[model samples]
Target: MSTAGAHTQHPEHTPGASVRRTREKGEPRFPDGPKADPAGSHFERRIRSFQPRRSRVTAGQEEALQRLWPRWGFDVDGRQRLDLAEFFGNDRPVVLEIGFGMGEATARMAAADPGTNILAVDVHTPGQGHLLGLADQHGLDNVRVGNGDAIILLREMLTPDALGGLRVYFPDPWPKKRHHKRRLIQPAFLDLAAARLAPGATVHCATDWEPYAQQMLEVLTAHPGFENTVADGGFTPRPQFRPLTRFEGQGLDKGHVVNDLIFRRVPHADQPADRAGGDHGADRPEDRDAAGT
Candidate 1:
């Protein structure tokens, strides 16, 4: 999907970025909220650690997302609320699909199983209009779109363990090696994602990039709270209702390998802290290795 977000004009990070703190040398806390920086505050720390790349879509293209910002039909709950919540409708299982371009797969899934409600995030306007139209056509009340940074929406806004599952499909690779840091799948993002996922809920990610697939495996495989549910060479067909995007079909024709990574959320022992491969990988019975969607 063409994103509301644009690619970066400059590299987000420079050499020696790791040692430097993005904030002031010695930061003071605000009495009210985070904005009380006695000195004139700079937003570099807030927008992104590195400079955030931005792209300006045409006015027409930007309209849909603008329309979406106001009350988006329904909240996480089955009830009507002014706000969107991770556990919006009491305790109904909520699934999040990031960057649900045009709602093709999302609409199909919601139609297939009306029991589950899906909260989808995307910045693209045309896609939002397309999805909203489709949902209305199908009379699907289960799908909702929250337009903006999926990262911020998940991190700053949502409550912990609030989501039953998550799906990220075909995110921009940001192909340049140096720009790989700009990719959505990363340690920081995973840590936040882990906190919102309920135990037994699955996080599914798919990509057409072979190297990014391996990179995802390397990073997520070591996560303490998530376990892979596939064999060393396991492959799963696209789940039912996942429409074939033009690019995906083209990639298949060109013989590019598509990789899917599915992970299960491991329950936190007692402490509700983030786990990144601490003793969790130790006890699983070697024979119980399973495959995932």
Candidate 2:
């Protein structure tokens, strides 16, 4: 389950969201395990926030994936609680980055903070290859790649309060009004994040899509377990650690504005008892139960 492979098709309800699907008779209806089709035929296995796209992978990128991935990449289908010390071979604080497209920013961030282990997740194969290539190029041991549904990884594999920080940068805006439901920063997503983040842990999200930025701000502000880092509850200036992405640079040329939101996980006293008590390095019996380990 920890290895990268094809998604096992499950033409049934996905957790946290009910999706309607049509499949031919006798097609596999249950998620057996990771199957390796890059075509992404197993969409029913999870209601993903991003659509899998087919992109060209150069020979060098493929070479990097084959060589470096065994050391630094993992699949999101893992069900057991991942031991951070074992995963990174270190005790450093770990940051979970969701949807690290093309991985330039992800690699830069990993380079900037050598003490923090970054477990970046994405479904794009080429991007995963590209990021692995960068990690190899820079000799970075702190960066790891994950491919599959991030939601499942957050809910199933990660223990409560096991994260030092989380970053989600420029996720697909899903611009149509009707498609807003597909946005990743929903209330339920925040709830899952609250359960996994340690007290005082931060979630930093950035987007160039204005509407999505506003929605992200509203949802993060509304979540009781988190408090905005800004003094007036507005967007924060881009931190020096975040390099401007190519997409963001193009948007800037077109007069588009980017917004960054940072929210800290509130303490136990500030949140309801049910949502409290997941401080970093603290393990509870419930974690084992949650992972069914």
Candidate 3:
């Protein structure tokens, strides 16, 4: 799955980037929304799980975004459920990957399983561009990228039982005791994930942070709609499919422990009716974890 030998043209050297400019001139951006602020401005109105970071997009990334976004990317602002078949041009099982940093693993998984479409979501512009560029270079039609709030995408854009699997690898630990609530894997998140997952769909999460892993385990185990895949009710071995990412390797070198928790969504017949109708918490300042998704 190594992207070795893939087209390596630098942004300055890449040709035909004008494709984006030409298309943008005539396109109406779908799912447009107001930009979020840093100090919890309007975004703070909702409990946000992530803090918007400032990062510059590379020229290559810029061009790729301009050219590829209209077709494969979307903003985090629509209220209607997206038709998966219409979006991807096929109804293949959709795997939603949240916060796919730089998309090394996302690309590998998408490429590995042609039968599944990988919808990679994140807020980082450069990362989104890099992933899109890789997708184009590799001719991976099964991969689509989203830029915006994953929480909004889950709560609004995707319908219940619409996802086949979800992968959240290496989410920010928000290690500070005071900021622990900002962690993405929470009871509400599990509730939301469970609601969107089809029966038997799996949620796989991995983290190099131990305390965060514990929180994930406890929250996931407690969710009635999700059943842990492990027999002893503990972390499972990293499946062969999940590649060893550079970030994970760096953590390993620093003696950081990594944990992976896999839980399957229970069938509708097995779900407790009360628990099945999950409370889709809205944007509010006080709900720290609510914002984290």
C-alpha RMSD for every candidate: 13.1, 11.1, 9.5
lDDT of 3 at 238: 76
Per-model CA lDDT versus the true structure:
0.60, 0.76, 0.74
Give candidate 3's whole-model lDDT: 0.74
lDDT at residue 276 of model 3 (Cα atoms): 45
lDDT of 3 by residue, 72-131 (tens): 776666546788879899877788999988888888877877778888988876788789
Q: What TM-score do all the candidates reach, one by one? A: 0.66, 0.78, 0.79
Q: Which structure among the candidates has the greatest TM-score?
A: 3
Question: After TM-score superposition, what is the CA distance of residue 249 in candidate 2 from its true location, in Å?
Answer: 0.5
Which candidate, 2 or 3, would have the higher TM-score against the true structure?
3
For candidate 2, write residues 138-247 as lDDT tens digits: 98989988878788788888998788788899999999988888889999999999888888678889999999999999999999989887868988877766789898
Candidate 2 — which residues are off by over 4 angstroms? Answer: 1-46, 270-293
| Model 3 TM-score (2 dp) | 0.79
lDDT tens digits, residues 1-293, model 1? 12233212224444223222234655632111111121123112342312222333333323333343232422222122223333345445677888876678778877876766788866554566557656756987677775455666676567777677788888887778888878888888889999987766677788899888888878888888888766563434565445677778889999988877778788787745455223322222111233321
Backbone atom clashes (below 3 Å) for every candidate: 7, 2, 10
Give the lowest summed-lDDT range of ten residues in model 1.
Answer: 30-39
- Residue 127 in model 2: shift from native, Å? 0.6
